[model samples]
Target: MQNMRIVKKPGYAVDSVDRALQLILLLQETEWLRIGQAAKALGVAPSTAHRLMSTLVYRGFALQDDQHRYCAGPALHPEPAVGAERALVAAARPHLEALAARVQETVNLVERVGATARYLATVEGPQLLRVGNRAGTILPAHVSAAGKAILSTLPDEMVSAVCARQPPHGGSALTAAEMQELQAELRDVRSRGFAVNLGRTEPDLAAVGAPLASGNRPAALALSISAPLSRARQIQDPAAVEALLTCCAALRLELETQGRL
Candidate 1:
């Protein structure tokens, strides 16, 4: 008991600093937490915990609900701004280049941020005239091939939830029935072993994608190649789709084997 040395209060220190740090760590375990739950978890008085949470919220390190529950704030989990986005673009360059080289079209590595698939990296096609998509471009997830390829791998509940938050193109919103339809489409993508956006998002641009796995989770990343819809229609050879599947398979294998994705 003597070695335990519990200090209930520190002399001349910031109010509730220890408890605030503990709150941060606890929030890291989940998305959001109630103030009462946090108080109970930390075994602190509810009022004391609330005060600490208020301080954190004031600093943009946390947010509180109308009922006074707390969540990790924007400052602590800042969205990828210009600098981070640029870094992602830089890191994914080689892979995008390789995928482009293989498919002979513009290749893009994209990830869904909220309801949009933001281009993280890209490489030009080998042909003189080819579709070009650059980094920082954000497109609707339901419409983009890269978005579908990645979204197809997510759980149905999650996909529905995200789609619900955003308006779909050429429509007011996606109904539950429509979301289920999207899920069906994703299942087909999983069955076909690839995702295709046939000018769904952009006119005269068509693309296909395969999943990139990370650990037990599969398709955390996606590799997609895009070209003019007219050219894509002419090159509807079954072998080409097969080749894209092979690339996805190889990339997944390489990522797993190398312990990185």
Candidate 2:
């Protein structure tokens, strides 16, 4: 991240607790984090950083690599999240199938999680060659089609804050310039009412997605259609977009009626 976005600290915020929480957020953002980087980000001494990380490692919330860099550990993902997602998958199944039938391509449902998007469910297409199921997959929110759509629904400042934490690791990480470009893309997605991914997440694959609402309020859920790069144009067609939006609306309405949204 080129610049640190300002976080409004609560008046009663506990310094040790807050620093530990910030460290957790940092670990969650980057694939790997050096102790020095953590100390710098949290404005704590290197010794304090080590002690903090020791606690996280003890709790299984963080782990150290051979190089001593910190990364997210197993405890970061809890069973409650998976249980809630299972309910979401069941509620959205019919619409996912409908969207898959309409586009005749792989259809996916994703939920935005901080700066990432989690693939909760997918309905594979009938084509001989197509994107397979990505259920339970997690990708950066800025790169995935549905993730962008979900982020577009958030306030601009919130979106910027989310993009600012992009870790400095891997080719998939968005740089400062790339984050700016994503801002521009989100603007178009907001106005166009849908988002597109042209091989951003994976080469030779293209996808389009639209955000959905929960109980009349904007939510972090999106439904997208993925296809082979050769069928990219087909997925972006007006009919495909309409079909996606129609299914999202229907699903949103059903969930709202059932008090599930």
Candidate 3:
């Protein structure tokens, strides 16, 4: 006769509260969850799961879509702005270094702050004519590859709002015509999956940049490679573009896997 094994169910010390907390954690990681799915996962009745979800929604800890699926709410992620920025820079540093080495050009990690792009981290290349370290520098977003790349991922209305509030410094004041031109350029950036700066921000300097997707939200961060115009001929080359995209993709994956995104 063959031996048979039986599985036993474990009892929870405080089932309802434990299940509710578990649901919150689940919603954080998942795109959406249905009550039935939650009940099954928690080994509870569907009605019990529904009540828990309703409480979470009432408290602004979860949101239900038109389809009645639940997703994470704003309250679940309340990290302060400065803390978030530091975390983003810490997560991007290694990838930026690797990309700089591969492209033989300076690499920067920047985040959009109002109408400016703040350079949070930078890695200088080995080349003699490479761009200088841009860490701690802030530049007008409309004229920067990293800033343009991030802006390209945002809604048009939000981009318009930012532009209307702050014009690029020491450059032509933004007029309606200039805004239209910028919109066209952003469209091209979205289509090409990257943005380019051709001596726009700084003379004889160029860069190519791509936005870093933040899981379910619009990208707030970007990565870019900068080089002197003499060596920037390869900016649009297949290898250089591939390296930039590949590096950004890897960085995004790492952030998502670490539950930081």
Candidate 4:
């Protein structure tokens, strides 16, 4: 325990505010937290933890579910600025171009909107039978590789809410069995750190995608390599997955570094 020396600062921290901020950070790291867990983590009494959590809930920084578990609130993920979409596209253009060059396939940057994903930017590959630009097209999130990549990063409840509000575009409502199957696929995507759409969005199209994380937070953005189904067999190829992941990492690093600015 010699390595655990405690330093007492003179005039820096306030205990209550510090504890509240710590709770917020904890919420960021996990899907949900209970009062007992928060109290134990912060070395506070249960009453104190309850008070702190109540304050957060009142201020919209946290939400208390029916089970009394605390989860992050909408306030934690603020809406982007007025022209933020354009800025995102501008920052991502070069990276998308590089990815398309490396993978020899069309690359796209997509943003999640409700239950749909809207293409924000795209870079086409050199292949003659390449997928076309989808810069402004919107598609069902459950059927798009990029959408699945982004969705896999969200909590189950939030995903369910989005699905409930905006069921798939052209199909009958999703049955409970279908929802469970989609959840399983998202779990697989989470485990593999990427997602694939094998002719699900369009019969002739296939793609592989990975989510972009900003620090510890999952961004609403994803990047994908799109191609004709014939060439898209690469979706399952380890080499192709590696290439897509590499590009995703590069883009994530750039976004993180720029965020500091």
Best by TM-score: 2
The RMSD (Cα, Å) of candidate 2 is: 13.5
Instruction: For model 2, name the residue pairs that clash.
Output: none
In order, candidate lDDTs are 0.70, 0.82, 0.82, 0.80
Residues 133-210 of candidate 2: C-alpha lDDT, one tens digit per residue: 776456778888999999988877888887677433333445778778988999999899899999888889899989
**Model 1, poorest ten-residue lDDT window?**
63-72
Regions of model 2 farther than 4 Å from truth = 1-81, 167-174, 214-216
Clash count for each candidate, listed in order shown: 0, 0, 0, 0
lDDT, residue 172, candidate 1: 48
lDDT by residue (1-261, candidate 3, tens digit) is 998888554574577788889999889888878999999988889999999988887555676542467777655878695566667778888898899889888999987877877677789998887898666556788889999999998888888888777433323446898889999999999889899999987789999989997544688789999999777778778899999999999998998888776
**Model 2 vs. true fold: TM:** 0.67
Find the 10 residues in a row with the least total lDDT in model 3.
Answer: 165-174
Runs off by more than 4 Å, candidate 3: 1-84, 167-173, 214-216
Question: What TM-score would every model get versus the actual structure?
Answer: 0.60, 0.67, 0.65, 0.65
Model 2 whole-model lDDT (C-alpha atoms): 0.82
